[model samples]
Target: MADTFLKEQVRARSIGDWIALPVLIAVIFAAPFFPAVLTSVPNWAILPVSDWVGEGLNWLARDAGVGGVTFADVTRALAAAAEAPIDWLKIVLAEGWVTGAGFNKVQAAPPLSWLGVTLAVALVALRLSGRGLMLLTLVSGLYLALFGLWVLAMTTLASVLLCVVTALVLGLAIGIRAYRSPRTEAFVRAVMNVMQTVPIFSYLLPTLLLFGYGPSAALFATVVYALPPMVHATVLALRSVPQETLELARMTGCSRAQTLWKVELPVAVPRLAIGLNQVVMMTLNMVIIASMIGAGGLGYDVLRALRRLDFGAGFEAGMGIVALAVVLDRLTQAAAHNQSTQAVGLWRRRDTVLALALLIIFTLFSFVIPSLGLWPKDLTLTTAPFWNGAVSFINREFYDPLDAIRTAMLLKVMNPFRDLLLATPWTLIGLLVCFAGYALGGKRAALTVMALLLFIALTGYWEPAMVSVYLTTLAVAIALAIGLPFGIWVSSRPRFHQPVQLVLDTLQTLPTLVYLLPAVMLFRNGDFSALIAVVSYAVAPAVRYGMAGMKHVPSERVEAAAMSGCTPWQTFRFVRLPSAMPTLLLGVNQTVMMALSMLVIAALVGTRELGQEVYTSLTRGEVGPGIVAGLCVACIALIADTLLKSAAARAARHEGDIHA
Candidate 1:
């Protein structure tokens, strides 16, 4: 009886209940004065793999002759073949195709004129959305032309188009295969989680090796970065299709291919549209970053402005990026939901055909009037000076206050937090993670967490990893502080919704590089500037999710609280906030992920973290260091994500229990 009772007691205890006290004691005793080996990764234990990777890359760069057939010859041949379409697209869209030799070289011109492009885009927008979107599309094109950004904008557009198409096609193919095979799906999910978590910067080095530096390498990296979202979204959409519907299709004698193409795909269009939207946003986000790897476009312009400290030029390029992101986002979103609306006439439904017809006419007319083929140089305008002056005026007027805020934040918040994180021994941190993981997800998660932590430590990146963790944690805390209040205020007022959402959308979609310039302008370089840039990029999701959660609170619950004579604050605290807590937690997850993604970009402004390690590795063409540091960041993200998801699940269960 005593043996059974002991077994019962052990089984009844939660992981945390059983282990928390012991782990807490261990941390207290070991954290502050731990041995150097326990506190950090020792130099002798460092991986020698980086040197091997460097040697391998050098070997690949050199010519290897096999009976006069050199490796360089093969790579060059393949690269040129792959680049053919990209080169053609860029020239056709931006410079028009040229035909004829040497001195006789003359523009054969693209089939579509600037006028045609504008008209076609507007028509497509009209078909997808309505007159409002159509007008927005027209204005966006005019802005590009009038600002003398048409060529650069078109270059960026062509790159994005190629990347998006390739990513979507590839993602769909993989997603479909994964959907068909449960094992494949599981493996793909694991790979995607890592891929999505890895910083975009980490992708550049290996791609630079395989494709060499230029638009081709950048294109390859962008596709890889953007592909996961599409694949995940496609999987989700396909899986979401009613099993009954699929069964019915199968019963009707549909072959596997037929069921997929004729039944599943049609129904999956809306969900696939969501994936496409993600692909577009991700593609545009990478546009500027890719420029760093020799994929020039408007991103090149933004990079130049960053180096020169020209806010005006940066702002212009930034706006152009925002414009492109907004247009793509709107169009793709509209496309996703378009099928649900009432059907219209052929002219409306076949808008693509109409747009094509108009494009042909406009192109033909442009042959008669050559200026229509390109945006006229004499008509271009630039507002860089105005933006520069505005930034200057703001800096002069608010210098003291901004400086004070920056200084206090560095001294009071960032520095202490970073030092504390750095000083904490890895063993203690690992133990804490193990306990948390076990509490959240049982033995598998605990082991998984420990293994990843051990891997990071063994890579000799433990300190930099801690620095990244500190940066992410502090930035997220600040984002919540600001984002929650603002989100609450905006959510409470219906009148503020659209404008606030628009601004948030822009903030979310704007390139990471754009945030850097403003950070430099305001805080200069340091942890502070890095903090500002990260917060700017990350805060939007927090605000968005908070507002969305509040807005989604059950109406009846609010009414019940009111009837119970609760004050507004009391009602919000007792009713709305608790109900919305799960979603708000989800928002926090997104915010942390976003902040981690910015770590590499933050390093550019002198924030010492794993991101700096990754960036340094990239510049030196050292693959192992970049990858090891990236994995550390991914591990942090994975740990945080698992904990938060567990917490949210627990909250949901508790609420369900209370209701029961």
Candidate 2:
């Protein structure tokens, strides 16, 4: 039967189909050889995302549609934006009032005698998470006050408060909706995928337009950018609420709303708090980034320090951001943990107390020493010399040679592969997906892939979508190469698995900005750099799940393999690997989604795919195009996720029977 099945597969295609595929591929290969292929002619024009990137460069160099750079006009705008924040800040610090001529930005809290603010905050901390959290919160406040950053910290805090509260409300509401309705769940998940996959850098331009400048825009951007995690957590929390508990609630003859409010929501609170915690941390992080668009406070200070090449101030500010991230992170985590364990005590209440104490200390310092959060007039610290010098050194030293490799690969390898990918007929690809999905999972899986692919086509970004698909395919291949073996090796040894898991966590948490651009310098642009960046970010889940699946190999199965005089390789291959294959497949599925996400983010380093279009659309102020491309990306994630999850379920059910 196996031999007949193999023969049937070999004879599945007609000669003409095979011949036409290659010819079609070759035609795509030759088209790009024409210089004007990407540009427009008189009547018709083909402007790929790559073309838009070139145009953006020209726009920056030339005056674009505007007249020459009017220094006075530019200066007037900057001078105005610059003056408002400082003036508002001074008032807030001095009179505890920010109300101005047209802006009734009345400071909310009555200027707490800095001392009073501290006591109030400390007391609040004492109520929430316990003594340890209270102490940490107190120290944070004291540090801010002593450093004279009290006023700035308060400004930051006020902003954090508003954005996070809004995020929590929206996230919780949507999350619950997602859990209850299939359509809403699909829509919400789709939106979440796009928000997560799109780069922060890509959205900033559009955010600038909508928010209409300053703190208002920044706050709006903050809320939008950070809302997804909260929503996702809320949904997951609700979904994971024990089935027995829900049954019990229903059995109580309670009305649906009553059951939800008194039973379901309370039961789900522990997990739902995770979403709130995530929202808080995310909101805080975005606030620091908000400075880019004139949201005042420490973020702007860091931005200025970076522009001026002041490494010291930049470093200090960066630390401050990190400290802030940690404090918020700790508080949220404590709250979530305490709630989850249903633990109640003085210690558990500390996080709230700590937060309040820090607030007070912050207020006191704001009115006293001004420099804590303020940059000195000379603005002595900068990183320009270092960054510029390093950039120059790398470009001249290592990147040049690396670029040569990129050039060679693009001309020879990727260019050829690009053609091969395009040559795949939509119909044949559909059949292939259907067959693969059916073989691994079932009818539902086949339909899922069809829907995903159909969405990509209907979006009117089919060609660029194919390019993205090709790049993601290549990335997944590379990711599997690195992640699988490591996963298998670590899983085999009990001692090493824990350590490997720790490494995976670290890789997952490191911000994309830290390594993504540099990775481009290493591999250069196009599919290669995008591939590496995607591989770096997406590979973690693959390894983690692979390890998990393998380590779960039944003890009896392992023993049986040993009894058969199996070598280590034989044991893993014949017993462990087969057993873990299902989980490993799920890992690959996650890796696919993650690869797409990173591909979008890596557009910063120049990827000639849908992400580039998303980038271009934002710059051109074309929201429709950007969102269209974003939907395509989301479709790809959902497709892979659905099919793989189905397969994992099937495989996990096979029990301890070793195929070998």
Candidate 3:
């Protein structure tokens, strides 16, 4: 009787009881139907279905009474803010660069001869990455010059370099503060999420309002967009430093600043260098989006070419950006990699030598080459004509057929599935997600996903949220198809791993917008087009996580499986995969988050989601709606992340020994 009483006291009845519990998830989502009694609920069909949303968008656009912007007000606000100076020293050292006043500004001198850039970059590359990388820089410079995108690429490079420097300083400053204070650390983390999740378009408006439309606006935007990663990384790196190193500095009676500069900073240098590299890479990732707000350079060229439907011009222009990225990435990455402690003189140091050479060449050219002394006029390489011809041929020969195939896929496969998904009972999705949550994590995970998504519904954007969810599902599915196989193949050979890792790094830095033009050209505007974009962007994480998981799988377990006479397939499937399951889930979580985020960019090809709404609302000056929709995307990402992370944690306890 006592045993029965104890068993009853400790029964897992909440799991069963919660099955009948009212889905308290009305906060993030709305029901399709409700009675007057239930109508009092927050998300009880607040916004109708597709029919109402279409009408609201039309009415909002036509209803000029609610939201509007005046050009004069905007210009006045910008002029006042842009002239605000940092310290006079910083102004002289950094941001005080003056350019021309007209339509075509002479911001900086251009390299006249292809040979100048090649030689300078080759010197840098050779010092950093040796013969092979030097050759790459030279070849990449030639591509820029030969394709007629040299000037535009330089424009983009100048802005990126400016942003990179600014981001590093700001990130280091904030990171230092955050590391010193627990409060600041928490605050920094909160802001990082906002910075990371807020659409780039949303970011541009306030920046434009403050700085006006120029490289300055774009530069600040890029800085703001890229700064958080370095800040977070720096704080983490500093915190991870050995306590004994800090103690030694204290023992020397070093002042706080001296301790930091003399001891802590040196120990943190490698990690700080990594942060600096990330700053550069993230700046590169904002290319075409940065161009949208009036920043000039290769992005502008690509945008103009895209607008003109000149695929060749855009393609070459994009390649110019890629070339520069390749050169910069290799140089920075190589310098970080070999970690040479052999002290060398400043005169012979790789970075110093390269910078000095560039300076000398530029200074000399100012005297000798009239063309290089100023920005070039009539600087057209004219890839446009070829692009135009290709556009015609593709539209006639390839695109139409591709579009037909895409249409068929949509009609036969995607559209119906999307509809079926949208029409699925909200309860069933909640329950299924809840079940997965419980299985992966537990009750808490299920509740978090439920609560976050329900909040999106309460905001009255559930349908577009639904649409976004559908696309996210599709993109992740497709990403898995590509990432999983490549992961398995890469696992077989050690030689392929490093190069594949390098490719993944490049992909991480490759701007999503730059890829959008090509994706649009190939796939056109539709669900399929959007899917391709998401797949390309999201697959890198999947592949990375999968490789990490497999590589970390214990060799002893594999040997045992082999000893049991297991085939390779059986070994991987039954032993390795199960062992790596927890880490694989982590990768899937990232893949899903990335896919959801990319949906906003994918909307350029016409995806109807919170992303599309956020884009449209930002343009329309509907800050409320824009913020709400952006929140929905965030909520969705968080929900999935929480659920997956919870599951991974629970499962990791069992498989936590696996390194990957």
lDDT, residue 275, model 3? 80
Against the true structure, whose lDDT is highest? 1
TM-score of each: 0.93, 0.68, 0.80
| lDDT of each residue in 125-164, candidate 3, tens digit only | 7776678998898888777766666656766776777678
List runs of model 1 lying over 4 Å from the truth.
1-11, 52-78, 100-104, 340-354
TM-score for candidate 3, residues paired by index:
0.80
TM-score of 2: 0.68
The C-alpha lDDT values of all candidates are 0.84, 0.66, 0.71
RMSD of each: 3.3, 9.4, 6.8
**Tens digits of lDDT, candidate 2, 184-207:** 999999778678655454455545
Best by TM-score: 1
lDDT of 1 at 211: 73
- In model 2, which regions exceed 4 Å deviation? 1-161, 177-229, 243-262, 277-327, 348-358, 365-401, 423-427, 491-506, 520-527, 551-565, 653-660
Tell how far residue 92 is off in model 2, in angstroms.
Answer: 8.3
